[model samples]
Target: MERERMVRKTEIVQVLRMKEGTGDTSFAKTAYMARQILLMTKSIREKVMKELYYCMEQPKILCIADLGCSSSVENNLMSVVYGLIDTIDKARRELGHGPQEYQIYLNDLPGNDFNTVFSSVTRFKDNLKEKMGDDFGDCFVNGVPGSFYGRLFPTNSLHFVHSSSSLYWLSQVPEGIEDNKRNIYMAKTSPPKVLKAYYDQFKKDIWMFLHCRSKEVVDGGKMVLTLLGRQNSDPCYSNRTGYMWELLATVLDNMVVEGYIEEEKLNTFNLPIYTSSPSELEFLVHSEGSFALDQVHASEISWDANDHKNRSSCDQYDFAICLRAVVESLIVSHFGEEIIDEIFKRYREIICASMAEEKNSVDYITISLTRKSRG
Candidate 1:
């Protein structure tokens, strides 16, 4: 295995957030990613709720954590929290248990726009009051700022853990193999060393994540995670998972040709992302020893899946905006802010051209894990 290299916490926190604000650049304004997250996690979410019902022998207070929960204005975080609560509440009624209070923790990198997240609480609370009336159990939501690669809570503190579209982000760009020339991610053309570097980083990060969660979750606790992934077992299946990035790379390469970007700069740029296969996830779970893989579900969603408002035509510019909200900060940090607009403009054209020949898509994996009982 390659030795681990850390992307400074300060650096990660600063560049990782969606463009913050309530306008066109803001992630809060984009509903596509949020909608798709809910759609993809629907099944395991219910599974986790069912597991929570049986695990909660004394259902007075339940502690739940949402990791990598970026800020959103649609009150997406609270909706998820409430959804979990509703599921648990329904299960409680069915199991002959009484009402219960909840201690919900919403976690993200320290640089996330938590002010926006906290502001939604008032509306969230108001909605709960209207929905449950006097029967509403107390729900307290707090923001936890840190990475999940290490312990973030007290031992035996969590009952359920949920993450969506987050884990595939490696803690850092793989260190030993930075010479993945002319590519921002592990493409089919990426060298074997590049592939091994990403695999090592992902394996290390997942193992550390499981190790920390094992100590924090009580026996039989459940974790549900939805990650950007591919159905193919090979990490180098470019068409399956790397097409979007590949397209983005094409835009950059074209810019380099036109002398709009420095060729040297393009050579050094690499995206710190890895999409794992289900077999890889299963292997990590079994090797970690503290978690048992209960389910692995894979599905393909359109590249423009989140552009619900423009579903009829599937415009590439709309998809560019969605991608911009999530990745603009990183791109700006690497390539400078001045080129941001031009880059996406060209990227939109590339996407539009490609759509005629190929309908771009990405795969997702939703997995449920049960905490192993300690001997």
Candidate 2:
């Protein structure tokens, strides 16, 4: 049984990834919400630059990593790197410092579409040079493929670390959740034990993540993480956006009833995602004892946040497509690609119906931490 569970985990690691390419269905298009959150958060910018300025006091190549830096043909990875470099360069000029060299590591799971990210590097570099002219610094971008729950970098290697729309994903589905039954996540109907199991899994994964990063990041370095979260302390609270997993569970149940999918398969399936509360996040950071919690901010974004006012006509379809880009890989890993269209079709219908009744918005939590000096 243990070996079987390990194999299942291996399969998940091998299969779980965002839908690739630059098409409408790709994560690149859907990821605008994440980018928007990162750009709009004034505190995030301030914290990043403050720590970067501290790192600039040293006269060496600065190391910056974007954990969970999923790729896209649209070069979303490059866009983020560009923003960071621009900010750092501006700070350097104000301090009367010379141009600095940078080592940018774009990290994601092995299943990520790294080819797309690497292919855009030359163009990205050229554009940077054109914009910065004589002040262009030597920037080298490399892709690191692995899980952040474990070590992915050498000790004291990273100066700044940023992760957006990630970290809510536990290393794997919480074990002993077989009794969770019809729900894919911790719903209001879930048993107390199942909730505890999920929270425990989150605590374990997050502690390991912090431990690994504490070793990789230099003392006094900084990290900012933005992830889907809930404002309420209870994990089982029924927020409208938290209903996304429940809606998927309902669709699977319907398919099971209609003989499109097996009942047992639906019973066994569970999403590895968790929406943590700010209190919960703070507790883990303190308990980990490696980093000092700097700031915690929570905000909400609507399901169709990326849609323009003129594009309201197809908001429902666009919302469904965006969700599909995020979860299609996991669904395909379990249920096969055969029913992908039908499942998302029903998902879209349900979303449209639900949206009419109430606005669906997800809570996002941004946490900034500074690495403490090693004892």
Candidate 3:
């Protein structure tokens, strides 16, 4: 199923591919909204850079990987990346010699649009060349779309890794727990079972990611992970948190009541589940037997306001757009891609009703770790 959806995601990304300077406004220019992505993990990245750049024995070449780098445009993430690179450049200059080469690997799920990423990289590359000609070195950039938790690169090869606003997404919704719409995760009146399911999946995936890095990243290499999250995962199932689950549950329940779908159909549903806390992340680090905890500071980052356009209310269509872009593969594989459009429409109806009153404010956390030792 995973492999099948991977192929489908690749197709969607290709279809939505944007040209250089043609994506969201912030992708090409740094706007207030675009600047928001840097909030979650800035402190950790800065501290890690000190250790990375200050070392006299640093490698002459750096290989970088941006996991979940779906958009061609750098958007808000560009700031963090460019900032990191510029800092390293400065440190090298102080030493009177720069690295011989540098490369960045942009990765996303198979369904992600590489063309968009390509254009973004091209524009950013030109910017770098204009500013620092000889010192910049060679940049070999390519797209790798696959689950980072499993495998994506060769052993002990990567120098650095960065991911933002993506990790909290679970690989799959837990099986069998969705029998009751009221107890489902991502729905209104969602039971604790649903939330717990998501938490479990996150723990598994984070562990997988850490272990994968242990095999692929060289000793002492660095990683920066910034993701959407909450201070705690356990929240009462009520509108106080979000109408997402409530509205979704209502929509699905109505559909079942009208004989539009099966009773357990909601079982296939998975919530956005983006909330994560520092403690959850720390446990993964210690038990995963992979990356070392260099630091775990909370970054308060931002994103373009459009990121929440549909989530702003119960607009089923808008919710679908956000869901499709973020988790389209899951939807297509589970419910049959044929009904994806209808699903979005139904989703928007419920979401718009929920978000009609309040403005959208999305919050997330960014964590950075060091590849202290690799297996």
Candidate 4:
């Protein structure tokens, strides 16, 4: 049974990806919230760039990797990469350094829409050349398809790494949580064993991630990661992410009761994501022993991606669409495509009803780390 469960997980990983393309219902349209969060951390990224400029000898080429770089026509991976190049170029000029080439690796799982990402590169380069004129060096964009939990780059190849809204996803679902019952994530009703299992799995995955990056990132290189997190220490606390999952589970439960989905299927499924606390992240980084913690900051944003004072039904619908863009693929893979529209319909209603009573917000944790010299 355990072997069978592992195989199931392998299959899920193989198919896991965000909804593709530039349509209204696609991840590209729904990712404005993620883009905002990335923009919020722009200052920290600038600081990292400045430090990188001062710390290392001016290289002819600067190599950067954006792990889990999902595809989008606008306001997505390419936007962030372009912003980084601008930051780098500005810093070089400020420091009186010569123009340098850039090698940007846009990485995500194999299931990602690489064609869309690749198709945008020519326009991206043309825009850069137009903007920077002779100051713009040869900027190369490449797509890397693989899991970030393992090695993806050559030894000491990357000088900087950035990931946003991605690390919360585990390499696989946590094992030994079949008894989590109706919950798809750690909840107040979850057994203590379930919480431990989730945390342990995160620990294992994060440690392996750090170990792999340690081999690939140059000493003194910097990494900035941002993901959904909780300020509260208890795993079962009713944080916004947990509450959202609870609402999703509630919808699935109703579907099962109405015979729309199999009870056994709902019983065995769990999301391959975990929200970590600041302390938990700090502990893992210290234990990994490769990266020195530079800074960790936690901030909250409204779940509806609007001002709390003036949220409307339209905001609720947009929130539902955003959530669907992220998890619809997983739901379809597990239950079937027939239920996608119905599930999200009920999910949107539930969210609207719930928000009528109280506002919902999620905390985002951003951490910056510098690779320490090998002992």
Q: Best-fitting candidate, measured by lDDT?
A: 4
Off by over 4 Å in 3: 1-35, 39-47, 180-196, 233-264, 272-274, 299-324, 332-360, 373-375
Candidate 3, residue 137: lDDT:
70
Instruction: Indicate the worst ten consecutive residues by lDDT in candidate 3.
Output: 17-26
TM-score of each: 0.93, 0.94, 0.75, 0.95
| Best prediction by TM-score | 4
Indicate the TM-score of model 3.
0.75
Tens-digit lDDT string for candidate 3 (1-375): 778646643443443221123333212332232234554355567667757767536676677787766563466335666767777777777877755477677776665555656766778778777876756676667788776757899998887788876676556544345543543454445566765666676787788878887888888888888776555544443223243445545666676777765666655555535466777788778898677776666543222245433222222233334433444454454456676666657876656654565543444566767777523
For model 2 the local lDDT of residue 147 reads 89
Off by over 4 Å in 4: 1-9, 308-314
User: Candidate 1 — worst ten consecutive residues by lDDT sum?
Assistant: 1-10
Query: Candidate 2 has which clashing residue pairs, if any?
Result: none
- For 81-200, candidate 1 gives per-residue lDDT tens digits of 778877877777777776779898888888778888888887887787688665757888889988888889999989899888789987777776657888888887789999999899
CA lDDT of each prediction against the hidden true structure: 0.80, 0.82, 0.60, 0.85
Error of 4 at 283 (Å): 0.2
Each model's total of backbone clashes: 1, 0, 32, 0
Q: Tens digits of per-residue lDDT for model 2 on 200-280?
A: 999999999999999999888888888899998878765655788888889999999999999888888889888999999
Could you tell me how far off, in angstroms, the CA of residue 256 lies in candidate 2 after the best superposition? Answer: 1.4
CA shift of 75, model 3, Å: 2.6
